[model samples]
Target: MDPPTRSWSIYNRTEITQRYEILERIGSGAYSDVYRARRLSDDLIIALKEIHDYQSAFREIEALEILQKSPNIIVLHEYFWREEEDAVLVLEFLKTDLASVIREAKRNWENGISVGEIKWWMIQILHGLDACHRNSIVHRDLKPANLLISSDVVLKLADFGQSRILLEPGFVTGDEHTHPHEQNTPSQTWMLQQPETIPESDNSNQEQITMSKEEYFKELDDLKAKDSVDETDKETNFNDGDTSCLATYTTSDMEDNPFKSSYSYEAESEGDRSGALTSCVGTRWFRAPELLYGSMDYGQDIDLWSLGCIFAELLSLKPLFPGTSDIDQISRIISTLGNLTEEAWPGCSKLPDYGKISFGKIENPLGLEAYLPNRSSDEIHLVRRLVCYDPASRATAMELLHDKYLNVNPLPVPVNELRVPSTNNGQDESSPGQWRDYKDMDSDSDFEEFGTVDASTTGTGFSIHL
Candidate 1:
């Protein structure tokens, strides 16, 4: 098959070509394509992410810059952007991600991942997420695919395209307990707007304006507050409580019901602050229940729900809730954890599409124990903390780090002691050409082979299987 089309003219640019040897394309998505390249300056292997969407690029850049100091977060060396061109981000490259590790274990290990190794992975994930949460950033998309592992067996969080920095009321630094979405208005705008145009200049000499943490948060607060007021006014006449005026459903409504009401999940366009934050941001299998109900108003607790799903997958070497569509996703969730109700999660009825969608009540829900029969009680408790119906009751990353499960005698293994597969997709990485050939193959094919869906490719949601 012919190689996928390159939307960005990154290969032809003199500045990019001179600085990094574009080795091969490793991953692709609707708005971005990632390449495994060698830095010309230091011969260091790196990933060059060419993002076609200005909003996504800006968000990733801003989030990574704030998280550069954290060891568990991916390092953004630098980025290159110019007028009317795609942004190219220079990022650290890792041989494999947690998905690959899980796949390898399922194939090779007789008993699946060891308890100690699982603890190590969980510890790393918690640390990375703790760093993000501490900075008031929500990694809307968190799955095994996004949790990349380094050569030293260290896991770091990657792919911040869907991540949002909480600059609104409860999300400011030092206010950890307050839920971010409690007081959030429907008019709150995204902080990373299209940047002002810079004068035409050579890429090598382009200078970046770094904003201090204090100044950055201050500016974000001012922007969000201003946008909220302006949008509230524009929407005053149209903000009636009736939901009939919203975008109507289509023929595919049963398959993937589009969220288009005042609580629509569509991200606002460049100059349009009328749309609500998308609830359809994450992959289907790991998505939180509130998100499935089209709740645009949510907080970092959503990540905790995803963490529970990921942990369950690691234990069984199979996805806990591998749904095919949005509706199917909720069915699978209900089948396992019982039907969602106001008693379980108070105010859940206030969710955008909560009334629009309905499900038969499950009389006897099979708990996590049904899926993880042989697992230890502590292990079950660990997943239980984050997989509950109430978002407020979900455990935080910091709190889980100190849990009894992680502090036991068979504690988490050292980073160096953790095992990682030597080869990715049967390609020996010791050979540069072989590694390049492996990376050149489309990532979707690999995902299909493993019965997993790459969330990056599907703009909607995704799933995973054994």
Candidate 2:
């Protein structure tokens, strides 16, 4: 039995007949089922995130609206809800996610995705994050799978279910009983009738929509060329907050989850469970020290720490701090970052849950460079600034964007040239920065589906498996 809420836009195969041609189930996560559906109007294929929980769906809708103009943030097309049925979100369809890309890169190349690509992806993420911060929103969950890539290879931030608005009024307000009408839609209705960001077989709009090589390199040089960071900025450090990132703040499942289906149940309160939100948030691998202390008052600084962890992972091809539990997470952080004292992290002993964990007295010489020996020193320095003990010292998204590493000689591959984990065919489609002709694809299907698609050219018969 369905919950007494709203009707699902395209509940089953039958519902998609005239409205949308349901191609396949792209994915299913904790909150909703993501599908690749083709709009019958112009044969435009879009992603439908069908959500059963209205609150989660509502949050994502709200965030997307505020972040619609953000360069690398995912674009929302239209949204609707049918009471007692489901809430359907119409969004630009993306080919694969960063997680799938990472997996495919590891398979194709033993070393994993290149450093330039990592820097490129991070720059895009920072732009999206900066946009979120400017809009007073916090994406509590940031992971590989949540970052989707278009067919043209542009990366965008997706999945705002766990995001929180820092605006004065906060998430939802106003009278609940007020019925939604055509003129007066719900607060989450943010539909923009703009051209689809992710194009399908519509080659006519390729040049304008596709990410160009010049644009790609120019964007990479943007942050660095925009400003300068002094020695004080680089040396700024503190340790007031405990460095134990409540990696398992909510549950053990957050250990290395790609923000897919981790949050199944609520978490027990630890400390200072008042203010903006609870302390139980973030994934194990990318959590910050202050978050581990159950500090509900923490701000966007926590995200910088997570970004550092992510940046390090991208370079190393594995998580920098792979802690299974809260205590283990803290220890891992301390071992890599070294123990903190009151002199460094002022008022460290005063935190609510301080001294609850222990670690080695000194740090290991086999530091970040041990795994990333070949990477530029500047990149390593940037990562160190991000994963610092003091949240106050961590660089903001905008600041990190200006780091010199992004402007280095080996520029990131352009969008058309950037290939992902699931899309790596043995054949070279074109030069690194150019795209393959859409007409040449085996006439089997209008679009390609990940995971199940076979790389065979000689076969006579064809099949489309969702």
- lDDT per residue (tens digit) for residues 1-466 in model 1: 2234644578866677888888767554445567778889889988787776555565677777666667898877767765546678778887666766776787678878899999999999999999888878888778776787776777889878767776633344634432222121111221211121222342233333345546544544454443312343432211111111011111232112111111111334223332236675666667899988877778899999989999998999877876545555676788788878999889988888676655666788898899998999999999999999899999999899999999997988777777787533332235333223222111111223432332232333333221
TM-score of each: 0.72, 0.66
Q: What number of backbone clashes does candidate 2 have, counting pairs of residues 3 or more apart or in separate chains?
A: 21
Candidate 2 ranges beyond 4 A from true positions: 1-18, 169-261, 264-275, 363-366, 422-466
- Identify the leading candidate in terms of TM-score: 1
Q: Cα lDDT of model 2 overall? A: 0.56
Candidate 1 clash pair list: 265-278
lDDT of each: 0.64, 0.56
lDDT of 2 by residue, 13-69 (tens): 344445776665545433466666688889887877676544455567667765666
Q: Lowest summed-lDDT stretch of 10 residues in model 1? A: 238-247
